[model samples]
Target: MIQKSIFYTSILLIVVFISSGFKPYDNQIDKWFDLDNTDEALYIFPSQKNTDYTYLNAPFKGKFFVGYKEAIGFKESQNKYRKVNTLGYMGKYQFGAETLKSIGISDSLHFLNNPRLQEKAFVTLLSRNKFILQDYINKYEGKVISNIKITESGILAAAHLGGAGSVIKFFKSNGERRVKDEYGTSVRSYLKEFAGYETKNIPAIKNAKI
Candidate 1:
């Protein structure tokens, strides 16, 4: 009788422990199981933290691989030399027909087919943006807006994404004037991601060649 009574007590204790969310040390399972990755906890956790913007606050130094014009190209079209998006933005740098025409690329088919032309077009656009936003870059570079330290490369990248006018507005408003493309990519995002790079080689020209 005592044995049976002890067994019932033990079972009751186990049930109570489980109901109270208690588990033995050996029985503890990972709380992160099957949880969506976008969870705040995942973002805050040290082990799982994203390092995408770790260099945002770092000193102005160039990065390799996806740096300079190539980074912009990758962001636009994943560096696909022969690709064209649904919006008709063509080639590796995803230049619209109008933008291409402005840079002296009249034939969209020829521009899309020629990888060299695409590269030149990117440089030409960058040069043009540099000229247009030179004052803003000089004024805002090294200044922090919305916790992000502005850099020349960052300003240039933002200009590439949302035009020189949009970049000027973004900085002038202290990041209050939010500008995002159809892909929901914001100027701030580009500024943070592409903060440090060497673009001084590309001269600011009134009419850069494509």
Candidate 2:
């Protein structure tokens, strides 16, 4: 009887191992894995589907208390503090070297490695944009451009994506002139996506820098 029980247990273990090695093809299994409810007994393989809930749900669907700057950081680099894009944009906010220098961050390596500095740089750049685009914000806020409502935070976010100059052209053209980065992400897209955030704490300082 003992020998028979051992033989059965070994066979069951082998079966489980073989089953776990095979990839799951069923869509329901894929969905179960996608939801992240891991079950060892289910033997479901991991799915490569994107897990970013933001994409799965409505735009700007997240915690109400999430700061706009942090949200932009998430969008820019998925909030990876040490991330560097192919074009050499660095840090959580994806600051170009020139922009980093403008904000008093001269060391790209140090800036990329330092999360706090990157956050400060974002605030500084936003402050600078807010100062530079104050008149535009006052004039354009609450105005509709291409069916999207304009807001101060939106303008600042667009300025962060392209530049204050590009944002100005965008506004001056009444949404007729669209500006996109090398990746083809448009300034209007940033404005529209990042709108409706409370950024009043970022005080506008003339020529703001870290």
Which candidate wins on TM-score? 2
What is the lDDT of every predicted structure here?
A: 0.78, 0.83
List pairs with backbone clashes in candidate 1. none
Indicate the residue-level lDDT of 47 in model 2: 50
User: Which lDDT tens digits does candidate 2 get at residues 1-210?
Assistant: 999999999999999999998975653432323435554334445455666223622235353325676688778887789998999898888989998888787888888878788878888999999999999999999999998899888999999999999999998899999799989999999989888888777799998888
lDDT of 1 by residue, 9-114 (tens): 9999999988889643452234555447654332222333355336443223247423566666667776788998888888987888877777788999888888
lDDT, model 1, position 62:
42
State the lDDT at 13 in candidate 2: 99
RMSD of 1: 11.6
